[model samples]
Structures are given as C-alpha cells and as structure tokens.
Target chain A: MSRNIRILGTGKYLPSKIVTSEELDRKLGLKEGWAAKKSGVKIRHVVDGEVNSDMAVKAIEQALKNANMTKEDLHCIISTSASFDQPLPCQASLIKEKMVFKNHPIPAFDIDSTCLGFVVGLDTISYLVEAERYKNVVIVSSEISSLAINPNQHESYTLFGDGACAVIISKSSKEETSSIKTSLIETYPEGVHMTEVRGGGSILHSRHYSEKNKTEYLFDMDGRAIFRLSSRLINGFMERLFKDSGLTIQDIDMVIPHQASAMAMKLMRKKLDVPEEKFMSIIENHGNVISASIPMALHEAIVQNRIKRGDKVLLLGTSAGLSLGGLVFEY
Target chain B: MSRNIRILGTGKYLPSKIVTSEELDRKLGLKEGWAAKKSGVKIRHVVDGEVNSDMAVKAIEQALKNANMTKEDLHCIISTSASFDQPLPCQASLIKEKMVFKNHPIPAFDIDSTCLGFVVGLDTISYLVEAERYKNVVIVSSEISSLAINPNQHESYTLFGDGACAVIISKSSKEETSSIKTSLIETYPEGVHMTEVRGGGSILHSRHYSEKNKTEYLFDMDGRAIFRLSSRLINGFMERLFKDSGLTIQDIDMVIPHQASAMAMKLMRKKLDVPEEKFMSIIENHGNVISASIPMALHEAIVQNRIKRGDKVLLLGTSAGLSLGGLVFEY
Candidate 1:
C-alpha cells in the first residue's frame, strides 16, 4: 500500500512588476521604513495584465519541460489556489484550456485549503499516485495575492505578491524514487476567521452586493491574532509530525515553511527549532504568495542547491482553515 | 490494486422555500408555462437565509446518522461545490466550523469542477480509501445555485435550485462491499466557457466591480452549445465506460445523471439509449442542483426504493469543464 511518489520536476512563475517595500509603504501612506521593518519583504511581484491561470499555465509548462515530458504525458491536472480567476469551471480547467491540452482530456479540478493548498494537493496526489490511479499528475499552486489584498489594509497590502509554483508528480522508477515519508493535514475551523474574504462568497451574493463597503470583499488578515493562535500549536504539531513520520528534526535536511509573514516565519522557525540555515526563506523577495509560497520556496531551494538528491525536506504551512499541514519527503 | 469503496449512507437537504415554475415565470416576467415547458422544472428549492455550508452540514449530519456513525468516526471531510459561502476558508472548513467539529481537527478542503464537483470528489475519495489513507470520509456537495442564477437570464434562472447531498464512504466489510466498478472523469477544458460565473473571481476584481454589468456575475449557460458539445461524446464516453468496467448498458439498473435540464436529460437518455425507466430524473422537483444533482438523485432513488442492495447503479454527469464523467457501482 505504500509507494514512493516522486517529484519529477518543479517550476515557478513570478510577475514582472516588482513592488518594493518602500513603494508599498508610500502607496499605503505608512512610515518610510515601517513596511520593511515589520515584514521582511523587500520586494514582491505584482501582476498587471496576467491572471491566476495564466501564471499557473506558465509554471506548469516549465514543470513539464523540466521533467522532459510533454502534455501527452500528464494524466491529470490538479490546481490549488485561494485566488481564482473565476469561481466557476475551476481554475484547473482554465489552466488546461490555456495550456492548449485540448487533445488530451484529463481529469482536472481545483482544491482550495487557503494557503495550505499546495500541501493539500501534494497530499492528495501522493495518494492517487500511490494507488496507481494516475501515472503523471501535474499539481500547480497559483495565487494573485495583489488582487485580494486591500490597499487600505496596510499590514496585508505590503506582505502579498502574485506568483505560482507547479510540480509534476509520478511514480518513481525502480532505480530512483523520492519517498514521500509522511503527509499530514489538520484543520481547526475555530481559526477560520483569522484570515478571510467575507464578501467574496455566497454571503455577499451578487444579488445583494452593493458598491458600498466594496473593500470588505478584499482579503483581511489579523496577523497578530493568527500568530498568537498558530504559534501555540505549531510546536506540538511539529512534534506530532516528527513522531508520526518517525524522524527527528535532525533527520531533516531543510524545512520549507510557509512564508506567512516575516515575523510569523521567524517565530515558527525558532519554535520548530530547525537550524536557521536549515530553514528555506523566500518572503524577502516574494512576500506571501499564499498557497504558492511553499512550492515556490521549495523550487528556489532546489535551484539554489539548498536541496539536492537524497535530501529530506519537510513542507509546512498554516492556512485559513486554521489548518496546519506538512509533507515530509526524500528529495 | 483495485478495491471497492462502499457508500455507507446517503443524505440530502432541500431548502423549504419551494418556488414553482409559474411563480418563477411570473417573477422573471416570462409567460406562464414557458418556464416549465422549456426546462420541465415544476418546482425547485430556494434558500431563504441558509448558506452553502449550512445546507451541507445538515446533509452531512443526516448522512452520519443514517450510517449510524458519529463525527468521531470521520477521518476527513471533503466538500465539493462551485458555489461557496465565501472564497477564503474552503467550504469544507466552514462546514467543519458550523458542524462543531473543531475538536477533531481533521483535514478539510474543497474540490470544484463546476457541476462535476461531486463526481471528482467521489473519484478522489475512492482512491484515498482504497489506499487505506482514511477509513471514513464524508463527501458533501452543497450549492446555492439560487444565489448565482441571473434573474435576467431566464434560461439559467429557471433551471437552478439550492440544495446539498452528502454520503459517507468507508471500507466495505468483506461480506458487504458495494463494489465501485469504474470511476472516470474527463475534462475538456475547451468547454470551460460553456457555463460560468465570470464576475466572482479575480477576473472581476472586487475593486473594479461595476453595478452596470451586475447580471454578469450570475450563472450564465449556453444550453444549446453545452448540449451539442456533450451529445457528441456522451454515447462514446458511456461505451468506453462500460467497456472499461466490463459491464454493459443492459446490466445497469439505473443511472443517476446530473439534472442539468429537462431537455438535456431527455436528449442524453435518448442518445445513450438508457430506457426512460432506467434513467433517474429529478429535475422536475429539484431542478439542476449543480454538483448536488447526481448525488441528490441517487439519494432520492434510494429513498424511493428504486435502488436495492444488489442493483447496479451508475452516477453520470457533464459539468462546466464541459467534462463528462461516470462512476458505476453496485448498491
């Protein structure tokens, strides 16, 4: 029943428009160094004309190329995102359309668990591959954080960027396989309101939507509250994860934690007690791309030689579900 | 590698507000009998104050009760829907919150493929169960289509109803396994535009939402186009499905297909050569409940004593992915 679902390739796409912390501060009318000092984000990508699926398609294409495979090789496409280009048809379908995989009609869908989307997708696909239901499954986490963040919300506006990450998952050959050791996802719905877009759903139906209070539809985050709540359980959660996986912190090569915020990441790293050097951080340049953050960081770590073959990497993050999830694998 | 995933129980929730076609026709300023004659929907449930998660939780509770289980028995909760009460915390998370399952902290997420949402979830949970990842998973499809239908778009408005359907999937005992014979989902991204709500996603950013194109945010359907596109493939798709499952059309006791529309249902039944008695239809009483249509129909069939323990049942549907999917199993 256990099988190694290998990560064949990883790829990411960042927008062209780069917004520095100082620029964001100016836009939000905040003190000059307040933005950068509060959040470690120096510069982040902001989309202008591109959409969520556009970025996802680009990342997926790169993943396919990196895996040295073509569209024909993929048996399924799973898109993970909190920021959708549209609510209907699912973003995966849009990505499939944009990618021009018309000849290959695969099962495509979107899984949303807020920021833990990528990990949720990874966990789900790992099982699918393990079950031998699919051979080559493409998983993409794409986000347009800029579209969701309210500019008036100074704290959130300066800490979000638009980006996407994609990975191709398949059963490894007998000679080489990345053993996905353990995958765990737990959600405490009590934390659902820590981060939310109240007006963006059926609650704010189009029939009742008013131009007034338009900003309510944008993303809202109680950073301090989330940090306080998540920090309390993170240590215990990490312990459970390590215990369940039967691996100690010392066995991990690197930890790819969600770049939630500059402060949150620092605190989590300290609490998890992973060596500073062993933690992969990308928020300084990419800010928080929500679901894409983990995969984007993982992709960068591999490219920068922080993770290599035979390395044990743990992907971790907290999501809007008040969810904490991790995927431990040998790279 | 293949194993049976038994459906332990089935449940459905329909809003109390029943709007007859004549009432809808009057409200939409259409001629009497025009609405019912066109879509053959005599009545459909419309939510007054309840949201997607509200209905979903009710259905799930009923399902659990029907299965003679408690919340403690569920290892995971997967929700399927194109309509969300909100976009941030995933409907499954919201359901968890509303259902008072915060104590369990199980993995929760949402999968969306428009109307194919339920089928996709079924395919997914089956693999997960077959892989022994989870013992009992609750899959619910809750949709408030009444919130999305454009009153101005007569065709769509008359065809949608707010409802939810839930089922408990678990490992079947050796003596009672309801073998899931075949589960196939194919999405032709080419049809992503056939049915959609363009205004709810990043495409229609909240910041730029205009009241002028207000109706654009509601569900829009090109029924003729979807019928034409789906008709060309349903026969072939069903043939392939029967072939792969090692079954035949004659072997199936009943088919619970998505109640897309009365016209689409009749045409599909004729084209697929499924006898009128063999095709389970509920559009007249429930309309098209989007993702909940198939499950709701199946639940109704079970309640009406149409599906017995040893009968072969086929769940089929075409969704916004312009996707056609089918899952065959023995009750």
Candidate 2:
C-alpha cells in the first residue's frame, strides 16, 4: 500500500501593528470605507522591523509545538517567501542558521512560486513523503508584503499585510486518520503581469535605480485584472481539484481560498455554490499575506472550532505567477 | 510496487561570447594561467544581452525535441535559476507563457537552491512522478552569472559563465524503458555564506545603492571554504547515494559535479577514489554557471558518449544556499 503524507499541525503569526481603514485613510488621503468596501479589509497587520524570516520562525515554532515535534525530528525544511532578507544564502538557510540546526544537518531550502509558493511547497513535501524519500517535513510560508508595498500606491498598500503560516507534514502509518489525502495544482502564465514587484531583482539591479525611478522600485498591481483572473481561476481550480480528488463540494466541510480580497472570496463562494459560512476569511484581520493566507486561515478555522477530526477541508490559492492550486485534507 | 521516474532527454545552451584566460588576464593584470590553475577555467561563456529565461527557453525546446514530446505532453515545468529577471512572476512563468503548449496549461514555477537547484528540481520532479501526480515534467536550470560578476574583481570575475540546461523526466512504463533512475537531495544551510550576492534583495534594495558600495551588489565568494565543503560533502553524498541505490562507485559510468572549480572536483574524485576518466568537467570552457553547471556537464557527457543508455551517472552540486545534493541515475 502507498503511504500518505498528512498535515500534523498548523500555525500562523501576524504582525502586531494593525492598520485600520480610518488610519490608512488619514495617512493616504482616502475616503473612509473606500478601502474597506473595495477590498473588504477593515484592518491589516503591518510589520515594523520584522523581516520575512523572523515571521517564518515564529510560525514554525508554533507548528512544531502543536505537532509535539522538535527540530531534531525534521528531515526537511521547505520555506516559501517572495520578500526575502537576502538573495544569496536563501531565506531557508537563514532560518536554519538562526534556529541553530547546524548539527542536525537536515536539508532546508526555499521554493519560489510567487503567492502559490506555500501550496507548492506543501505539494512537494507530500510527494517526497509518498516516495519514501523523507519521513517528516516542515513547510513554512512567510511574507512581509508590507515591505514590498508602496505606501503611495493605494491599491497595493491597502491590500497587503505582513504575516506567516506553517505546517508540519509527516508520514503516517494511520492512513485513514491523515489530514491531506491528495493535492492538485494548476497554473496560467497569461496572468503573470497582473501583480508584481517591478524591481529589486536581476532584471532591475541597483545600477538601474535612480531617484527619478523610485516608484518603479515598489510593488505595483493591476487590481482589476488580478481580481477578474482570481475570481475565474479560483472557481475553475477548485472544481478541477474536486474532480481530481473524486470528492464533491458537498463533501468539504470548509473552503479556505487565499485571502486576497473579500470580493474575490465572495465571488468564489457563489461560483462554487458554497455558503459563506463554509468559507473562512481572515482578510479583515490580516489582509493578503500572499502564500501564508490560506494556512493562516486554516489555523484560525481550527482554533475557532470550525474544523474537527474527520472533517474535509479544501485549500485554494492564487498569485502573481498566475499560479493557482488546491489541496484537500481530512482532519 | 513503487513507480520509477526516469530522465527522457537532456539539452543545454551556452552564451555566444567566450572570454579566454589570456583576455581576462590582460584586463585584470593577472599572471597567465592564474585562473586556469585556481579554478581550472581557461575560457568562460559570458552573456551579452541574453538573460536566464532566454537560455532556459532554448534548452527546454531542445529537450522536448530530443524526447519527441510536445510541450503539451508536459504537465509541469520547474526552472531553477539564481539570477532571476524579476522578483515576482517567477522566470518559470515566463517560459510557460512563451512556450506554445497546445493549450494544455501546464503548471510552471521557479525553485532556488542556488548551485544545487537543478538536482533539487530533478528530485522534486521525481517525487511528483512517483506520486502519480504528473506524468511528464521538465526541469530546467539556467544562470547568467555574468550579470552578478564584478568585472573589476579578478578574484571572482574570471571564474564564472552563462549557460542553461534542461532535462525531461517522465514516469517509466512498460512500453518505455528507464534511462536515468531516481535522485537524492541533501542541504547544509550552515554553509550558505560560502558564496553569495550580498545586495539587490529585499534586505538591501535599490534604495540603499551607492557608488561607494558597488562591490556589495556583486557576487562574492569564500573560495577556500567552499572548496573544503564541496570536497568533503560531494564525496560523502556520493557514497550515501550509491549505498541507497544498492550500487558501487565502480558501477557508475560518469560523475558530473557542479563546475564551481576544478580543484573542488579533483579533491572530490580523490576522496571518492574514482578514476579521472570517469569524471567530466566543463569549467575549462564554461566556468561556473551556478545552477546550470551540473546539467551542462551532463549534456556534454551525453554528447561525448561518456554516458549511454542504462549507464549509471552521478550528479553532485553545492551552492550559496549552502545547499548540496547528489543523484544517481542509469541513463
């Protein structure tokens, strides 16, 4: 019999500073309720000095504690983050060093799939465990979206928050009691340009930077295009995921779409014909944490008693790579 | 029974411009044979206007052609590159958009494990195929190391290159014979800082750029430290890989270590007690293409008849992520 990889625990960490619509409106000269109504974000967490790795460490610690596992028990550590502290050592290496796992010698690295990174990491870990290459893996998705956000760019600034989420996945002998039974992934490259950080990579190195091009260094977004694509793709991906898993929407006790915008989630709910109660949304408190959004939502759902043992949960996410993915798990 | 993932084809592309040691010595006021003796590189391919994505496209196209499979046949595309065109909308997405795949909508994204990226990507594809999640997967590793090179720094500039390499992996079936079998991945985050690009990421964005700190933006290396780690780890990894595969080093037809430096490979060969004739080196022509080195070496071996169908091949690589991995395959 084939072994199954399961999510043993979930954890999330959000910045303490919460920026309300009124505060942002005052700072950005926007009308009250405008940001709230359009993005369905009354407030969003923003990191002060904390970096992506810092947030990831917090989430991983919580996840390990919840799983009753220690760093020594981990065979792999896969971190996914778009806003990295550095380009050379990889954010994963930094986390490994900071956590002092030098003697453990476990393989740790980072995966970049834009916003769908966490799901991709999760899927990759599941594959490894199923292949019997590893016994335990820790997947962390951390993003300080606020660092990339252009304060002057209202569209992006009001929509992003700083946060991270993580889950410990391990090989389980009790196949019937596992969380993640299967995962399906899909991507559409046509939507790649809908959202992006226009600078800071090899494409726009420091040599190209000038005072006149300050705006180009910050995150940019085609809000309308992303919203339209997200609404269409999320529904299509969820449907395909259900078909792939041989499970119907009715079988899912909860649906956690990436918390990009409240409008996008509502549209997905309507398309999937699932009630709002079945869908979990953390946008009001954390905004869109990119790759961490779904896991953050899942963590919240579990704490709120929205998910229980044997309950089927569906996770769907989409991002700048025009990437979309879904995973089904029974907790 | 477990499924086996095998390599279907391999292809590589090098930049058109080649910088000979004579020219480099004159430019840097270095003694003749200095670079050749230190890094074993006599000439290095340098990118002109071409970027990582461009080279990857060429390799991917050739790999598909070699496999007699259309882009539509691929279910996933994973590109590994240290030099990315942008921070968002990963380089992998660009390839998916440019490649006409008969509307199959294959999932594509980037994975960054530095020099070990290609091996990591191959391992990922193996797991995906083993889980029956994907039938046809393409792994591409391309790097334009010149973009990160500090031309004034002769210590590092003369020992790098620009190139891309790709491999098509598929699930082995009764109708199709296996070529390359399985891969092993190991990472040592403790060694991450042995080589790195100190600037241009989120930690020190363009906002911090200054002429006085120009060197900060270029790739830096602790050559001696990396040499020590590479030599030690490559041999250890190879031994474990052969043991896991139930094979002996004498059974391998070729060894393709990352073309970081010739001395590193020589030391590793000595440690493994492998014959010089069984190992391949491309640093003499292409320098260190970072993530692209291993595949570029493998491509050359295949072209030179050093590797053949059912011949066991070993790939070992180490990079800034302080990430190191090894894979054993029968091709």
Candidate 3:
C-alpha cells in the first residue's frame, strides 16, 4: 500500500450524442417514460461517430490541462477500460498513438477489472509511484460500452452509456498530507458469468458469427444475480477494506460509488449509511459507463466542490468479475 | 526495480493436438515441406475444444505443484493473455472459478501488453510482492491464438500456436541473491497498427460482421512493417537497458527471447551477439504462441537445466504495440 501518492487532477469526456429514456421508450416500443422508469436513466451519452481511443485522448488532454502538465511530463500511461479500443496491442498503446508524443516512448499497459478498472489502476500504479519508478502517471478509464449493448437485452440496453475519465497522479511531497489510505479489490468468481460477453474470445471466435448468434457478441447480464451476490459480500468486503486501513465509514468525507445504476447506487448508499449529501451520483445522466463510472463520478464531485484537498474520500464499486473494490484516500 | 523477488516455480502446458508443417502442406495444398521452410515451424499446438482459462489453470496447477504449494497458497492471480477467454469479466476471474478454492476471495485482474504480456505481468507484480502486499502471486500468460489465425492469410496462419505458461513468484529473503536487476518496457506508438485485429472492438464492432469485412475480425499483420520498425529501434533499446543495469550481455548466463518467428528470433540473436549455447529457442515445436511465447520459452529453458539457480537471465521481446521490453533478472 502506497500512502504518499496523490491525484493531481481529474477530467472526463462524454460522447456528443445524448439518448433520452423517452426516446428509447419510443424506439423500443415501450410505454412513454417506461424506459426511464425502468432503468432510472434520464439521458445517457452515446457515440455517434467517435472511436474509443480518440475519446480517451480528449479526456487525457483535458486532464493534462487540469494538472498544468503536458504529455512530455508523463512517465507512463495506464489505460483502464472494460471495453477496449481494439483487440490487439492493448488499449494504452492505442491511446499513446493518439497522444502522438513524437519522441516519448513512455511505458504503457492495460489493467482491467471490468467496471473496477480505474480503482485497480490507481492501486497498482501507486506502488510504482511510491517506489519512484514513475514520477507522474496518467490513469484513464475509457469505455465505448454502447457498442457492446444488445438492443434485445432490454434490461441492460437502456442502462449503459459511453465515456472516458482520466486522472493525473504523482508522488506527494513529504510535507503534503495527500495520500491513499487503503484500497482492496476482491473477485468472487461465484458470479463470474453473471455479466459477460461470450463471443469474440477463444471459446467462441467472432469470425464464426452469423445472425443466429448476435447476442453472444454483446453484453449480457443477470442483474439480479450480480446484486444478490454483491449484496451478500459487500458488507464483509467493505469491513475488510476499512479494517485494513484502520478507518471507518464515518472517516470518509465523501462516498464515490460506481454509478452502476440509479437504484443500485441509492440502495448501496443507504445500506452503507453514508449521508445523502456525501454520496455522489451521476447515473441519472451518465448511465453506467462501466469502468469509467467511478472516475467520472469522482471528476464530477471534484468539479462541484463536493470533495476538497485533505478530504477523506472513498471510492466503491462492484464490477463484472463480481469484483468488489473500495479505496479510501485523501483528495 | 524490485530486486529481491524470486520466481519460485515455472510451468507450461501445450494443447494435445500437434499440427505438423507436413500436415499443413497437405491441408493447404502447398508443396511438401514448404510450410516448414517458410514458417520454420515443425509442429505447433492448437486447442481442440478446451477454453483458454482451463489451459491456464492446468499450467498454474503444474506450477503450484512444482513450488510444493497449492491454489490455497496464492495471494493473487494476475492473468496475462494477448487473446482472452472472454471480453467481460477478464481471464483472471475465469481462472479463479475453475480453481474452485472456496472462501479465498483472491484479488485478480487482467494485464494485456499483447505478446509482451508475460514480461509486463512479472514487472508489474514484482512491485506488489516487494511491498509485501501479496506474499505469493501466480502470473500466467495463456493464449489460444490459433483461433485468431486466418488460414486465408498464409503468413500469420502458419506462424501461430496455442499454449499457457505460468510462474509463482515471491519475495526473496536477505540471504538469497534472487532479484530482478533491471527491466525496461518502451512503447513506440508509431507502429500501433503494424499488427492488429481491427474488428471485435469499438472501431469495428463484431456485431457489424459480414463476409465483406470478415478479414477485419482475424489477426492481420504487416510483418515487414513491424520488423522494419523494431530493427531500427532494438539496438538503442538494448543499449539503454544494459546501460541502466550497469551490466553487459556477457554477464547474462541465459537469454530468452519472444518466439515471434524463427527468422525474427535468429535475426535478434545474431544482432545481439549472443552465443547459440546461451540463447533459448522453443519456437520449432511451439510456434509463436503470442503472449505465451517468452514465458513458455523461459519455462522450457529452466526445465532443460540450461540455466541454474542464481544465474543471470534476460527476457526480451517485441509486441503489437511496437513495444520493446527487456528484463535482466537473477534466476
């Protein structure tokens, strides 16, 4: 656990097109407002013409500006995405190509924990920063999940969006109090197949595709199964996380949970007993952006002054691994 | 840069079926021995009905047995795969499920650097082991790349095999000399598209599949482009790597290079001036197993007793990112 790393800046990028739930209701032939009522998503961003890496680069540029740093200052780029830009070369390499830092062969790679990518990236890279191997690093979670949405899977169809969120982080000075308290990510494989895309991998090669198996290539989820498994484990997972750092839920000044869904968020917040004002929510407009959810919500919280420097903040999320991840840090 | 981490054990698993070049000659209607002459592959393994994670778990089980430990001893599972089991929950989660270790909520994730995945996985996880965050970590690189090879593309079709390689690594005590001397991974994004699967991603969603764009779904490569770019950079890259570690190639007792292609391996070995006796080669039988190559080669080298404990070892490779990685560690 690296205790002296700090997040210098944060930024997010959402695709231009917005699809309101009412529009989805009309498109899917559901009753008016039914889509919004079912998914609790009012308007969610969707990509009309943008590619994933281009959107990731835009978010990186914004983060660079926020941190008052340029691409030249970065020691490495860790791209975190549940959905990738391409199937080969890894996502960070594609992002690095788009950044076009002519002579900088900055070390880059991908760390994916599905929706928990951003949190895991932070935890993994903090050790490197603490070791002083990388002085400044950019961790970006970018997802073009809308492409994986199967229109026929009505439950998940209206509950997703496309976006990218980025953060520039560096080693804090000895005098600065900025640091991560602790973070834990635990995968309970009991729910491994609870959410998945069955095609496009070795088990079911995408080239074998035909109209008969289109759903296999798209995102499929048993939302109730995930919620049931996660709810059964969330209490113990969080208890272990806080106990590891010797901190409690009350020590957290703000709770930044993955905006999985409006209902899921509300339920988790109430279950955790975090005050309403302290819990962050972006799902109403952003939908569940997969890995980008937590970071995007954190970016919004920072922009809105909900979390300040030295404030104790906690990021919590349940990802497709049926993974539970929580991180408590000082902003 | 973690100096005291030691590889406790290593293992590899090749699928049951071996496709010989002679068989390919008959199958593809090419001249006898033409496939062998061109691809330099005698025989290669291909999965019949096995899933990627099952192969990985088998390899991990072998590695654990070699280490005199069990799955219960693992602190984390870091799965490295250029090709995945599935696109959703990640390869690690799937591997965990198959391990079936009840009550062990192992923290798991996926790290993909294309063919360089094994080297990158080791480098990244070394930090965690050094920090004592994880006492024992299993890093496995599994690839079922034969599924991605398009028989229509003669070059890549003859060049790939499928296999899994695994190693258990832990912290070395004060008396042990086992340590990583130095490692450097530099990604020159200039050649991002030199090799790729342009489909099954946001850019060309697999759902948009059709016979017209079928080629996009399979592995496509401009071999000359990658070789040309890599050759221009390898000397400087190796020079910097040895310079950083304050050691020359002469100090290394064994050299393990990625089984990219027999020609690539030969050219790289000759260019680096490594004696044939000290260089490791397994491409003849295994073919270019993508991400599983280096680790698979390393496992073979150790099994053959060509390198003893405490000997200096170097693992080097180039992947789809046009990324060059070099690691000199004490075995």
True contacts kept of each: 0.85, 0.72, 0.84
Model 3 Cα lDDT, one tens digit per residue, B49-136: 9888999999999999989998999999999898888788888999889989789998989988999998988998899889998999
Q: DockQ of candidates 1 onward, in order?
A: 0.76, 0.63, 0.83
Q: DockQ ranking from best to worst?
A: 3, 1, 2
lDDT: worst 10-residue window of model 3 chain A: A1-10
Model 1 docking grade:
medium
- The segments of candidate 1 whose C-alpha lies over 4 angstroms from its true place after superposition are A207-211
TM-score of 3: 0.98
Better of 1 and 2 by TM-score: 1
**DockQ score for model 1:** 0.76
Off by over 4 Å in 3: none
lDDT minimum window of 10 residues, candidate 2 chain A: A1-10
Residue B137 lDDT (model 3): 96
Could you tell me which 10 consecutive residues in candidate 1 chain A have the lowest summed lDDT?
A205-214
| Clashing residue pairs found in predicted model 3 | none
Which candidate, 1 or 3, has the higher DockQ? 3
CAPRI rating of model 2: medium
Residue A166 displacement (Å), model 1 = 0.6
Compute the DockQ of candidate 2.
0.63
